[model samples]
Target: MKKLTIGVVGAGIYGNYHIHTYCCDKNVERVVFCDLNEERRIATADKYQITGYKTVKEMIAQEQLDAISIATPDPYHFEPAKDAMEAGIKYLFIEKPLATSVKECEELIALAEKHGVKISVDFHKRWDPAYNAIRDEIKKDEDTFIRGYMALDDIIDVPRKWFTWTDKSSPAWFLGVHCYDLIRYITGSEVEKVYAVGNKEVLKKEGYQTYDNIQAILTMKDGSNWTVENNWILPVTFPKSNDGQLVVVTEKKYFKNESYRGVKSFTDKKESIPNYIFMNFTQDSASGFGLEPMQEFVADILSERPFRTSIYDGLQATRIAQAVHDSCESGKVVYL
Candidate 1:
């Protein structure tokens, strides 16, 4: 079998993982990195011992990339993804919430269909064994109440120091999208209506021009109701950067997962929850829930198999997120 050549856009936290996986995967022939930040691009490339480019256009022009992963910030996904699909890349893996707007999501889906390219959204929650087990149990019941709260937060340092684009995003876009996709994946239901409210005091007082938290009540098409809570205001002293739980209650059974506390540790100064489930590098070759979906995308392209998470799944998740943002702004329930 011929090895596939891969290129990655964005060299941030998540994008680095994609680079690592592609570099370590035996099926890949060559891997390249691209980022607008020259420092990050060169550093990541040097660390991984791969060629680096300043932009996707430059990378594509120079390399015979068969597959590309877009790990850019949420709002910047559309352009890179569009370029890759139009460039005839066989496989495109995008980090979730697909795109920043519903229209962009539609355009991506249309573009993928037009280009005959396979698109997979990196909603890694679907790959979680615990979440998959819950999904199986929920599938047994026709109806169930799903209440999920995923508060994957960072210290004030994230918005205040890490990146300055917090105003262009919100907790809804950053964190809520994951919960939305996970609930949809678990219950296999589309979000029909959304009522949401947001608080801006925390991040605002800290000088960030975005909401600190958002609470949304979602009504599923199957007549099931879900309450989702999202907040990025967790203190720096929190045990983990991400902390939350998910509960799916059916007539016969109840499943609850404390994902953050899956593994715990204590130190002299602070406590921490090491997330081995998402991306476990300590293993042979970065095998975990987060890496599985992406690897599956590559394998599917190589084997000509159907994708587990389609582009439509990404679009639906974005649609729900857009509605949640709309409801938060209008102070009324938004119907899908």
Candidate 2:
């Protein structure tokens, strides 16, 4: 077997995870980090004991990469992804909400096809066992309405201090895209239309030009509906970084998953709900759900099998998210 070399763009939170996961794989020969931030690039490289570059172009020029993962911020995915595919990287894995715009997603799909490269999106929610059960149950019934609320908030430090590009994204792109993809995965339906409303009061007051909250009503092609609510304005003291649930109602059965209530911990300083379903480091490597989806891409590349989550899946999710943004901007329903 030929050892595969992998490179990661953006040495941030998820970028570091990709590095960690790839390092644990026996088939991977080398892993490199690329980021515009010199501090983060050097720090992550030093932490992981890997080479680092200041830009994707520099990394690709120097390393013969077999695969690449794009973990850049939401709005900054298109360029790195395009470069990776055009560089003839065999496999490309990207964080969710494939791209900020529908046009970008379409172009990426076309480019991947043109290059004969395999592409997968990191919508890791699909690997959750509880969600998989829900998807199975929903697949059994054709008429099911899903009410999903995924409210993930970062401490004020996230937008106010962490990244300077918060204005380029919103809760819809940052958080809602996950919900949209999960709903589509569970229901096995495409979003036919979307109606959304958003407000920007809190973040704007803090000098960030982005939506603090958004509520979107999505009508699926199956005629069932999903209501998704997203808000990222939680205070710095919020117990958990994310808290949400999914409820599927049908004529014959009802299913609900209170993801946050599965585990709990509290202390004098703050409360916390450890995310055991996805990326639980307490267990062995194979037990973690977070890395399974990315591993699927690796397996597909090595075995020449089909990817579990195709580039089309990423494009469809991006389409619905882009529609939500359009509806929010136009203050009217957007038809897909």
Candidate 3:
């Protein structure tokens, strides 16, 4: 058996997960990361006790890495990914949406092929046991699909405080891509067209130039329709930072699921819902469907297995999201 050395790009919130996840994997011999922020890089390096670099080029040149993971912001994913691939690392596990634009996604795909690198996009929703159960049930039946409704929302603080790039990312790029990818994974279909509408008042009032909420109707190639709603302006009083609902209606059966899986807690300061299934990190371990994709990425690489999702899956999701935004701007249906 061979152990692997891994390098991670971006050392922010989600980037920390990538760093911690690879460190926890038994087959990964070493884990290193790069971040442009000197403060974050120094802190993360001291905390993880791993070498940190200022640039991907520095990390690639110094470390004999077997793979690299990209955890950059939604719009900035392309540069780090291209840098890693062009540096000759043969495996990658990228955080969602691949890239904000279809052009970037296509370019990344071409580069991956030319370099013989195997790429996996971290669309972790596919790892949810509930969603998997729903997919299994639908597969066992011979019924025609009718419609689906999905809405994913984050607390207002997400865009207002969590990131400085809120203006560069809308709800469609952040939350909507997860919904779009989940719909495709569940139904084994592709989106054919989209018509969308959105409002920007909430974020605009706060000086962020982006949509507060967006709703899009998707016509799938399988002839089923889906309505996806995404927003990050939920009131702070909401128990969880995020919440969602999934409902599907087929010819003979109806199914539903919610992000809150029957768990709640109340405290003097506030009420809360802990999504233990999504992600839970203890002193020595990390577990959850949310973190499973990273673990699987290392295992699959060592075992030479296929990834659950590919660059093409990332490309299609971006295509749908781009169309959704286009429709919102043009006030008309956009065919894909």
Residue 46 error for model 2, in Å? 0.8
Which runs of model 1 end up more than 4 angstroms from their true locations? 141-155, 282-284
C-alpha RMSD for every candidate: 1.8, 2.2, 0.8
Q: Candidate 1, residue 249: CA error in Å?
A: 1.5
Q: Put down candidate 1 lDDT per residue, 257-308, tens digits, no spaces.
A: 8766457888798778898877777423878788987788778888888888
Model 3, 67-186: lDDT tens digits are 999998899999988988998999999898899999999999999999999999999999999999988898898667899999999999999988989998999999999999999998
Q: For model 2, how does the per-residue alpha-carbon lDDT over 1-336 read when each residue is reduced to its tens digit? A: 987889999999888888888877777889897999988987997888899999898899999998899999999999999988877786889998799888998899889879888888988888888889877876775655644444444555666766777999888888788788888887778889999999989988878888888889999887778888888777777666665677777656787777674678888876788876577442224437888876776777888888778788888888888888889999999999
Which run of 10 residues does model 3 get worst, by summed lDDT? 277-286
Error of 3 at 40 (Å): 0.7
Instruction: Give candidate 1's TM-score.
Output: 0.95
Q: List the residue pairs that clash in candidate 3.
A: none
Ten-residue stretch with the least lDDT total in model 1: 146-155
TM-score comparison, 2 vs 3, better candidate: 3
TM-score versus the correct structure, for each prediction:
0.95, 0.93, 0.99
Ranking by TM-score: 3, 1, 2
The alpha-carbon deviation from the true structure for residue 55 of candidate 2, after best TM-score superposition, in angstroms, is 1.8
Instruction: Give the distance in Å from residue 153's predicted Cα in candidate 2 to where it truly belongs.
Output: 4.9
Q: What is the lDDT of every predicted structure here?
A: 0.83, 0.81, 0.93
